[model samples]
Target: MVLAAPLAPAAPASRAPAAAPASVGGVSAAEWTIRWWRWTRSFPDGLEPYLDRDGRRCAMGQDDDGPVWFLAGTDGRFDARRRCRVPAGKHLLVPVINMYFHGPRLGENAMSCAQVKRRAAVNNDYLVSAVVLLDGKPLARPERLISRCFDPQAERDDAGPDDRRGVVRAAADGYWLLLPPLAPGPHRLSVGANYGNPDDPDYGRMLQNFEYELQVGDPAI
Candidate 1:
């Protein structure tokens, strides 16, 4: 009789718990979304995490001293697969899909708080689905992660010369997830979302599918 070869071990299950804490490291989930956006815009064009094709730029805007790390979604209607190495013990903030509006920029009229909120919410109103998976296990109650309309101050660096800054009016709303620290090993995370009426291609349609293969420990290992 021929001897059978041993199969490889299965990858460990790394998932975001059903219920996230009220806050992580002194910051609320909602505020974390704002900070996530700021971090996304902190860098210039070539270094924006959202535009990073592969995960090499994952550390572009990271604060060396922060407790949480931010991940990005594609600009619009684009899919990206990335592999990254994250430090162990750091929480991960993922923006499943989100929208924001800041104004009084060049050639633009001032927008009221209500207007900003309304504009920011238009894309989300047509959301068809938003799915997040960690290690192939979906997160429970993804709708619970939706954020209410609120203003987020725009720092000087978060805006351009044509855009207003320093607490300028802004509003954002979308689905966001705060994943707790992962075990010091390999993990997989993916986000998929669809917005707009499929039948009408011109109706501000936006679709995104982002995949992240993460290693939550020293890459040298």
Candidate 2:
């Protein structure tokens, strides 16, 4: 009987009202939007031997074209209207050393099936096998193709190196085996092409093989 009259029904516990959404500059929360932009550069020159000041053969000028692949997402898909452009006066060098599909256009690094098919018609006699390496370690042996994205061809330099030590190939698709996770430091990439016919005018050669000093972890483009 000493229960203090059942605590007066717990006094009907009070509750707080929900907060309204935030707004910016008189715009409603639902109408607010954000915009971003990026700039990049690329290189067309292949890595090859060059003469130094002392007239000796040496490899130099190894640098990367700024950010190559740019991925953007709002939820997870790309937002096309929020686009970016390359900044003016920005000259990008070859940042990563890997076999890339290059077309006639300056910034046309990735090629389409039609473009590769046309090129294959002229240079169809040989194949190029690329054994990609990062920090002197093997990554993948992506097969090189003729103009066709999936038509695998023979090597351009068969007798030069037997170990497949520097071989690079193109895939049937217009994609190259890209070296992965290049650190922010000095790095070197070597390629060996097996051109099946030495006397053929379309014989392949390891053109771009050099080291580049990269500034990794930089903000994305």
Candidate 3:
């Protein structure tokens, strides 16, 4: 009997990990909720003593304290015992440190500190990337790049062009790029994605023209 043509190999099936029980410091599939209230008694002047409730303050400068308390929670997949307590379901808590920033320009916004710390506490995974450009032009390669993440509230700092928190690459057509780790939510991207020849005064000037606004989340694009 004539043999039929060889059958094509079957495609492998995709599989998702099983949901884990919620714990105080581990990974779990259950959704966790965190409730926080401002300590009005201790912070009578509001979140920032220097800035008014309306988020307006003197340009000269003002004094303010960092985040009040940091809450730590887990999903019971990794470290079972940690600060805070939880039941058999997913558990979430606000970090003891305030990692958000609310100001005249910053507004009430959450930063990566809360997202990364919580994910790590629950054994979750996250990623960050950057897009570089010069004078609005994409680059082929970039030189001198750095990235890192921190609590803007605690640091009392603004995300600047030089801060190491995203990807940075050099371009062949005169554009430098930077991409950084980000969680679901609205994010502000600032880039110094260009370099100038030392002999050319136009060098580094393109940096002033670098700026971008983006949002990332469940429906990330």
lDDT of 3 by residue, 1-221 (tens): 11111121211223221122233233111111111212211243433321222112211121112111122211111121111111112111221111212212222542344344332222111101122222243323222211123322222225542233332211111111222223444433322222222433422212221222333333211
Name the lDDT value of residue 43 in candidate 2. Answer: 16
Q: RMSD to native for every prediction?
A: 8.6, 25.2, 22.9
* Minimal lDDT window, size 10, model 2: 32-41
**lDDT score, candidate 2:** 0.26
The whole-model C-alpha lDDT of candidate 1 against the native structure comes to 0.66
TM-score against truth, every candidate: 0.77, 0.31, 0.19
Worst 10 residues of 3 by lDDT: 168-177
Query: Which window of 10 residues has the lowest lDDT sum in candidate 1?
Result: 1-10
TM-score of 3: 0.19
Between candidates 1 and 2, name the one with more favorable TM-score: 1
Candidate 1 vs candidate 2: the lDDT winner is 1
Please report how far candidate 3 places residue 171 from its true position, in Å: 7.7
Better of 1 and 3 by lDDT: 1
Query: How well is each residue in 98-169 modelled by candidate 2, as lDDT tens digits?
Result: 222324322336555466445534332333332323345443443232222221222232433221222222
What's the TM for model 1? 0.77
